[model samples]
Target: MDGAGSGVWNDGSVHVDDQVGQGVSADLAAFLRNADDDRPVKIVSSVCGECGGRVFVVLVDDVEGGAERVCTGCGGRAFIADSAEFWGEADPGEAGCPCGGGEFETAVTFSLAADGPVRWVTVGLRCEQDGLCGIYVDWKIDYGPTDHLLALA
Candidate 1:
C-alpha cells in the first residue's frame, strides 16, 4: 500500500480487463507527445464525482489510463468520464498553448472495468488554430468546475 492513495497504471490501460489499450490513434498520440511546451502527463487533476474532492494523478513516465475510486468520504464509487465527455472549453492562452490560437480543443478517453465500472480517464488538449497541444490524466473524481455545466446536464 505504498501508494494506497495514489496508484500507478500504464499509458494504455483501457477496459477493466487489465490488458492494455492506448485508446487513441497513433497520430494523435504522437501529436500530444510532441507538444511544444509540455509533456503529456504534466498536470492531471480532477474532483471526486462522489463527494467533490480533489484527486491529482501521480503519473510515472506516461500512463494515460484513468483511475478507479472508492469514495473514502462518501463510501461510494466514482468514475472518470470518457474523453468525449471530459473535454473542457478553454482559451489557448489560459491553457498555455504555444500556438496562441483563438480556439483550443481537448479530447479525453475513459477506461471502464469489466464489472462495468469506470477506471480512469486520459485527456489531450490542442489548439484548433494550429496543432499545439498537451496531454494529461486525472481521477474521475467529480464534475469539477470545468465540467460543472456538463454535470448539470
Candidate 2:
C-alpha cells in the first residue's frame, strides 16, 4: 500500500491487487491491465476505515461528476467531486458509451503513503450494457489532503 513504486505502469491502467481485497472481478482486472495508453487511470485501499471491512461498492456517473465509494461492512462512505482542482477535464458523458449505453458500474482504488496520507486515486468504469471496463479517471494528491479526498473513509 506504500506509494513508492506506484503509478509506474507502462499502460495507463491502474494496478489493482485483488488478493489484498475482494470484489474486483478477473475480467475487470484484465481490462485494467490492458488499458489503452490514452485511457484515464488511478488505486485500491487494503482496509476500510470503518468496521475494518475489505469490500466496497463504487459509482461513477460521468467524467465531470463525482464518485462515491461505500463500505459494505459498515455502510461508511467516501465521496469526491470531479470539479476538484486536481481534476481538469471536460465531461465525457456527452459522448456516451461507445455502445451507446448511458449507465456504468464503477470501481475505485487508492495508493496510500506508507506512513502518510493518500497519494493517488484511480476510478474504473464498466459499461452496464456491454460489460466493457476501462479507466474513468484518476488524480494525483500532491498536497496530501487525505480527509478531503477520502472523506475520512
Candidate 3:
C-alpha cells in the first residue's frame, strides 16, 4: 500500500496491466531512452505555488510527460486523480519541456513488470539528476479501462 497513491495503480491494487500488447514497444522504447540518458529535467510541483502538480521527464533523447497527485488539504499522495478533488495544476512550459533551462547530465532507471499469462506491464522509474539529485516514478496500469493517461501532463 506504500506506492498505492503514487500513480502506481488504478484499481487500488499493486498490480497494473495496461502497457501490454502493441503499446508495449513504444512504452519500452521510451523507458529505455529514459534509462540510458543522463539529463536534467524539470518537475513541476503541485504544492510549490505552480497551481497544480505537473511532472515532466527529460532524458538524453527526448522528453516525456508525467503526473503526480496528492490530497489537496493533507498533501497525502492521492492514488486517483478524481479522489483528490483538485486538478488545477497545469504545465506552463513548452510541449513537454520546461520554459528555459539547459539540459544537465542525468541518468534514470526504467523498469517494466508483467505477471501471469496476461503479460501485463507496469512501469517503474528512478532517475538521478546531475549525480546529485535522485527521485523515482512508480506507476501501474489497468487493462479493463484502457484510457490510462498518467504520462500526460
Candidate 4:
C-alpha cells in the first residue's frame, strides 16, 4: 500500500501491513492480506450476539482503564475485561491525539481462514474529539471454531 503513513511488518510468522488515514476498510485489507499465510490469527465479531445486530458503538478510555463494544440494537455490551488477554500484551496506556483527547471511537476487523475460522484481528481507533485515527491493538488467535471468539468482540 502506497500512502503517507503506510507500513508493513513481517516477523517470519506474522505479517501486518496498514495505512493510516485510509479508514477502516484499509485496516481490514491489511489484516486480510495475510489471512492465507501459515501463521496463526484471531478475530472479533461485528455481529452482536444478543440481537444479531451488526452495528455497534465502540468506546475506549485508556486512562480510565475501560473499553467496550455496545450493540445499538439491543444495547448489549462486550467488555474489555471479558477478554483481557485476547487484546494482547500491548496497552495503549497514554495513547491519544496531539489534541490531548483520551476518548476514542473504535472499529474492529477480522482475518479469516479459508476454512471459516478467524486468523487475525485488528482494532482501529479514532479520536472522538479530534478525528485522529490509528490502530489500537491487534493479535493472533491460535484456538477457535470462531463462535466463541466472535462473542468476545
TM-score of 2: 0.47
Candidate whose TM-score is highest: 2
Give lDDT: candidate 2, residue 73. Answer: 68
Residue 75 Cα positional deviation in candidate 2, in Å, after optimal superposition: 17
Candidate 3 per-residue lDDT over residues 1-153, each given as its tens digit: 222122222232222421212112223223333442232211111221233322223321111223333223343343221212222432312112122332211112222322222112222222212222222232333333322322221
Number of the top candidate by lDDT? 4
- lDDT per residue (tens digit) for residues 9-114 in model 2: 3332343322212444545544644542333233333245567664445544454444555555687765543334423443333213578764444445545665
Task: Kindly list the per-residue Cα lDDT of model 4 for residues 45-95, writing each as its tens digit.
Answer: 245568876544565544323346666678887754334543353343434
Show the colliding residue pairs in model 2: 42-122, 43-109, 43-110, 44-109, 44-110
Global lDDT scores for all candidate models: 0.35, 0.48, 0.26, 0.49
Off by over 4 Å in 1: 1-26, 29-93, 140-153
lDDT score, candidate 1, position 85: 38
Q: After superposition, how far is residue 107 of candidate 4 from its true place, in Å?
A: 1.3
The alpha-carbon lDDT assigned to residue 132 of candidate 4 equals: 62
Against the hidden reference, what TM-scores do the models get? 0.32, 0.47, 0.21, 0.46
A best-first ranking of the candidates according to their TM-score comes to 2, 4, 1, 3
Give every collision pair in model 3: 8-140, 17-141, 38-106, 39-106, 52-89
- Candidate 1's TM-score reads 0.32
